[model samples]
Target: MSYVDGFLLPVPKKNLAAYKKMAAKAGKIWREHGALDYRECAGDDLKTAFGLPYPKLMKLKKGEVPVFSWIMFKSRKHRDTVNAKVMKDPRIQAMCPDPKQMPFDVKRMCYGGFKTLVKA
Candidate 1:
């Protein structure tokens, strides 16, 4: 079974373009480094439900929304290897060229690595 890594964060409206550019580069890097798939989805359709662990209601600014992304790998070992390379890649390093350009709050970001429990 494949392994999946998930991430969720809030992105500033003014930084959406910058975030997209960085995400594109990151997706490519993940693929090249051995990820089966790398996908980023702007959080538009998220809805609240009882007892959900994720934020039921995102506290958005005047024009901001949450963002979510995931990367699929053949297994945990493959994910580890790919992540290592991606982290070391110059392209990934350049994504955050300046502190002010970072789109999301790194401290508030949520991430987890999961083992596939069921698949179609």
Candidate 2:
């Protein structure tokens, strides 16, 4: 099984492009630091008939949408190692010198590390 770090957040529609640009750079940094895979996806069809929809779950405001992202690694230990290097990376520091400057609210972002339970 592999390890994964997942993230879910709300980003303003007007900031989506900026968010995508930032994510692309960040993904490259993660991959360069040994992440097996990295992906960032924006929500498209959020309206649903059943269960809690992302817009509701995230309490999305006008012109805001949910974004989901994840990074894969060989294992939890590997994830930790790669992330440590990524944190120390100068590019990352320059990209996000102040969390408050991010396109979305960092405080509203949800993140968790998971152990893969099943794979086909």
Candidate 3:
């Protein structure tokens, strides 16, 4: 089964473009290091009729927006290997010397590893 890493964070509303640019660069690096796929999505239509929405999930604050992201790998071992390389890549280090300085609130970001249950 495939493995995945998910991330949900709060980015400042005005930093959307900057966040996308950063994600694109990082995604390319992940792909180069063996990630099968990388996706970054900005929240829209936050109001949900039923359960919790991104805004609520990340506890989005004033002037903030939610970004939902994921990275795919063939398996957990592959993910670990790819991530180790990605972390050491000079480009990534230069891009985020201080995670807190990025366009989003790193401290409040949510992240987790998961094993895919189904695909269709």
| Model 1 per-residue lDDT tens digits across residues 5-98 | 9998878778888889889988988998889999988876556555553444455555666888999999999999989998899988887677
Sort order, TM-score high to low: 2, 3, 1
Per-residue lDDT value at 50 in model 3: 92
Best prediction by TM-score = 2
- Model 3 RMSD in angstroms: 0.9
| Residue-wise C-alpha lDDT for candidate 3, range 18-79, written one tens digit per residue | 99999999999999999999999888888999998877777779999888899999999999
After superposing candidate 1 on the true structure, give the runs of residues whose Cα lies further than 4 Å from its correct spot.
Answer: 47-62, 97-100
The superposed Cα distance between candidate 2 and the true structure at residue 14, in angstroms, equals: 0.3
Pairs that collide in candidate 1 are none
The CA lDDT of each predicted structure is 0.83, 0.96, 0.92
**Candidate 3 or 1, higher TM-score:** 3
Clashing pairs in 2: none
TM-score, predicted candidate 1 vs. hidden true structure: 0.85
Per-model clash counts, in order, read 0, 0, 0
